[model samples]
Target chain A: MAFSLLHGVHVPHRKNTRDMAAVRMDAPKTVVIPMSMHIGAPAKPVVKVGDTVKVGTLIAEAGGFVSAPIHASVSGKVTKITDYLLSNGTTVPAVVIESDGEMTPDETIAPPVVDSRDTLLEAIKRSGVVGLGGAGFPTHVKFSVDLGRIEYLVVNCAECEPYVTSDTRTMLDRVDDMKTALVAMKTHFGIRNIVVGIESNKKAAIKSMMGLMNEVVATGECTFTVKVLPSVYPQGGEKVLIYHTVGRVVPVGKLPIDVGCIAVNCTTLAAIGAYLKTGMPLVEKCVTVDGGCVKEPGNVIVPVGTAMSEVFEFCGGLTEAPDKVIYGGPMMGITVPDTSAPILKNTNAILALSKKETKLPKTTPCIRCGRCLNTCPFGLSPAAIARAYDKRDTVALDKLGVQACMECGCCSFVCPANRPLVQTNKLAKVLLKEEKAKEDAKA
Target chain B: MNTQLKLSVSPHIHSGRSTRRIMLDVLIALLPATAAGAVIFGLRSLLVVAVTVAACVGFEALFSLIAKKPIPVGDLSAAVTGLLLALNLPANIPLWQCVVGSLFAIVVVKGLFGGLGANPVNPAITARVFMLVAFATLTKAAFPTIVDTASSATPLAAEKATSLTDLLLGLHGGAIGETCAAALLLGGVYLLVRRVITWHVPVAFIGTVFLTSFIMEGMDATAALAAILSGGLLIGAIFMATDYVTSPATPWGKIIFGLGASLITFLIRYFGSYPEGVSFAILFMNILTPYISSWTRRRIFGMGGSKA
Candidate 1:
């Protein structure tokens, strides 16, 4: 009910790309499979050169507890296993497969013929499902909890960040898949309370899901609720959404799981639903490729690990070379080094921005207007901490709660004087954390 | 040929709002007051403002070039300084003195302090105070009333108090802008409507001046009114002293700022030697802005609210 201290920048939505057309699946000649797709250790290639592999077949198993398995999205001849550049500009081992036009999946773990609902845990683990939202944490790890505390299951349909409509389009086109996934989630977690929190900006998606949920509710298939959240940037953030929907705040440095709830992106759940019905693993993901620089900009269903070049090529090959290529939405996306880099499993959008869009002005000194403080959602002084870092004053930095900052770029967005507040705050947080660790060691 | 993409964080599309936009809006807001001055003072006021702006912009470019810093002439801070300097000056001041004031405002107060937003003090007020100390006679030059065409002094300069109407209409001669209370009020109102300034500073300033004078002078209505609407108070309290960078950030801080300026202005005009105290009051308050902001900062979120 209170005004959030931080007001995010109002950027152009660019959601018209999805409304203009349907999701077009890009059929590439050869899909480049990046071995390391999830957060932790890079995957080791399990197949060698000239090996024939089919869709849903695992090319590389999970390298560690934090890692997820890599699967082939298309039936193809394994051309070579070589070190290839990723979107982050780092080289990772990739499985290059030339599609044979058969589109045959090697083998699928058949849904429990008696009851697919019962195999939810094993299906999720074997499918190597990770959070498709952005963090890409292993989903199995979240459901593996026996603590019996998670009270609410929140489906994050709040693709509230501007220029991102992948989740919106997915929910629109795959409503059946969404409901099935929600039911599967409800069955697996053994929770009766379920809510889908979609931003109000997504009118069509809200309408579509609302109608479906209403029908299912009347039929007593399963209890489900669809709620429209106020359209605000970073409202999609797990903790912020938890507070807005459930009226609870996860403890500082903790997650939604700690607060008796779990929030999963709409795309992640839809993929789960498909995996349950058709018994397919997560091999390809829906990505929004729209910005000023691209000649044809729309959402395309892309195979995981497909070269970004092929994705651009399918969408009219870009009008001109982009000044910057980001892997997610404009607000929180990662800028990729080369188009040759493979799209990871968690990738949601590939924005190709022209030079005009990416041109940053030369930074001036901070005027101490306190706009940064007013807009920091975490309620820390970004400007003060940034100033302390600039002056190398660790004590000042520590006093201002510099370590609590999430580096959300909200401060930088609202600053009139354009001080590099976020960058400096990042340095301050790192230095102070290091200092605290040393003191702990000495004590 | 394989072209690699440069990877960076999100926010790929900028808002295109720049320092140039900020400085340009400030210049636009000062237009009404500048035009009013030109209309009241005739060609001389126009010449002073024009020459001051030209000199300030020229000096800024020249300084940046000599110092090998990137030229920020397009940012328009120099123009803002020049206009504020001209508004603070008397209409009869010579063109050479206008140039000197511009140099002091732009080169010394603004540029030497690291240019534009980095300047700790409001360059115009700092320059005006500096010039008043260096050239007292020229700073004190008075003009004839528009209606009577008779040589007159400001109500504040009177050994005996003048009428409230003369102070309000600014019929009595003073500085270029300080003579016209009506024009300054109109500009200040426009700025308020545009959200260029809040009502705290100007309202508190004028209110404290009137209230203090009433208390000290025992409800002598003419003296009380003159004390409120006198030299530089309207312009200084509204524009120069309320600058976002140099002023306090909180609402209460601005109130303190206005009250401080009013107290100082009254003490200097009635008790101290200076007939006008707007410049000194603003400068003094500007020095206290940081402390006032720190003291009056808002309680952060969740601090005053019920804990979860």
Candidate 2:
């Protein structure tokens, strides 16, 4: 029911590897498992140097309730335990394992015994599956919600950010796994309606998922439908996806579950299905390694903790000296200043852009054009927020809900004057928080 | 390699586009019009353009040097203003006058107001207006084509008439470049094709000029047509008035600006002291751009009401 504003920038998608043949990498000789992969506290290493570990073995234990545990992808002996750099540039404690290449299986937990009285919370905790699509929040913590009157179970299939197509390719390659995962999630959580939302940009993905859903229906399964959303950047965001697919807006400062709906990424569901079926712990993931600077730009199935250098070598190394290298898609992705940073869990894509292709305008003054206002899905005035921050006007910024900015880079993308709206807003937010803290201390 | 690069966050990608590229594009778009101006107005016009451009670039470079700011002359904003000042001038204007105009434009109007995108008014137009007021007789002297070395007044000098063909071709007495309607049209088309500008400003401005002048001429359609065709209306409407940073943001605001400019120019030509009003009309509308932008800004989400 909501109409989007005008003058959306038509940037080149550059999803070169999406249709290219998907390749699988041979197990690397060594993998550096970083202790901190997820958003929460860094996981503590349970293994020491020279300790032999098998595939699916828990090498790092969860440090806190918010953190998720790490598993070994290959049977290996821990060669060293030290701090190593991640793709995000921060150094964290990592378990360096030299793989035996045999991929020996580790000890497994007993299968779930279904009892009507058995709570869904305990099953999720036992499985050890976290959200596999970027934000690696523990799945059990999300599923352990109060369920007196829950309604919508939204599966986010909208890979809106350009160039990262792991989810689309996964849906096409493994629809059965996705469906099964959705059914399992539905049964485990006791949710009624489930909506699979895919951006209409991927016609093949939409068709494959539709066929799979029809197969479920022909076998007399209950209704679960897939809705095709209009292709818009950042449509994969939980709040935006919810609004686009199901005519509902997640309240300001509230989660999707707060509105009786819980959204999960498509790749996450597929991983859940794979984990449940094969009894394998979360390890390797499909990552898109393509850009203008990449000699052999393609998608490769890689294990977690693979060094970026090895992956680039596998893909055929640099075509030219790359000016910049990014870990994820361009819109919301971060820049890797160091090439040695290892790709951890939730690493989706590695993009290396040539200098000519990757040049960005030197930021100029804000002309107050309001193009940022038009393009923002949240309907926040980024230009005004930016203007207020220019003068350190905290009151005006708070009035504009500067905190609500998802830092999605949409505003920056559309700005003709080339102002770094999100980056400036980030600084303003930190300063505002610090100012509040100082006031609290004074009081 | 023992070189350890600085470690940063996830989005390691960039597109090589810099401020230099954008400014270069504008300079490229202005090339055709600059050539047309040079050819029509002779080496004297070329001399003025060269002097103004050199002055602008020199001033910008000198300021950055003295103040220890990065030399932003590479952005080509100073050059753009230089080219614009040349277009707004008569071929006979002295070289020192052009230099003064360039200094005022690049330094006082642009650098003083915050350079490039932050300038409130189009710097070139500001310089033209400033010169017009300061050196009225020198600035207003019209230089007709020298077939037998006779100084003639411009077609707009008298409230009589001019042929559309004369206006279309460069066969009239006026500013060095602005007299050629054909050249202005060609430049406008090139800019539109390059996606450097939108059609809102030019279309509205020219449209309003035509309609307003037509109404003001009353019974004399020839005079109406001549008024629209004469002066610097074509050049100002297509080029100077539609400056991306100075123009209105909204489609409706652009239309309002077009109407406001046309109405003011018509009133000035019909009833005011000045026989031509293109420069003043555009400068007046430039002041209203901010208000027009705010009024026409898309409503902020959820402040007024929740629409879901």
lDDT of all predictions:
0.75, 0.73
TM-score of 1: 0.88
**Candidate 1, A1-443: lDDT as tens digits:** 55342344555566757684445564567888877677777777788889888888888988876677888888888997888765556788889999887778776545533244346776776677788888788776677666367787888888866777888888788888877776666555666667788888888889998876775465453567787877766678776677777766666656677778888888888887888788778988888888777778888888786888888887888887788888887767788767876777898888888887777765765655666675666667787677678788889876676766666677777676677777677778779889889899999
Native-vs-model 2 lDDT? 0.73
DockQ of 2: 0.25
How large a fraction of the reference contact set does each model reproduce?
0.43, 0.26
For all the predictions, what are the DockQ values? 0.40, 0.25
Can you tell me the CAPRI class of model 1?
acceptable
Off by over 4 Å in 1: A1-5, A85-91, A112-119, A212-227, A437-443, B4-7, B65-68, B138-141, B149-153, B156-172, B178-230, B250-276, B296-308
Q: What is the i-RMS of every prediction? A: 3.3, 4.1
Predicted candidate 1 versus true structure: per-residue lDDT over B74-116, tens digit per residue: 7677887888888888888878877887888888877888876
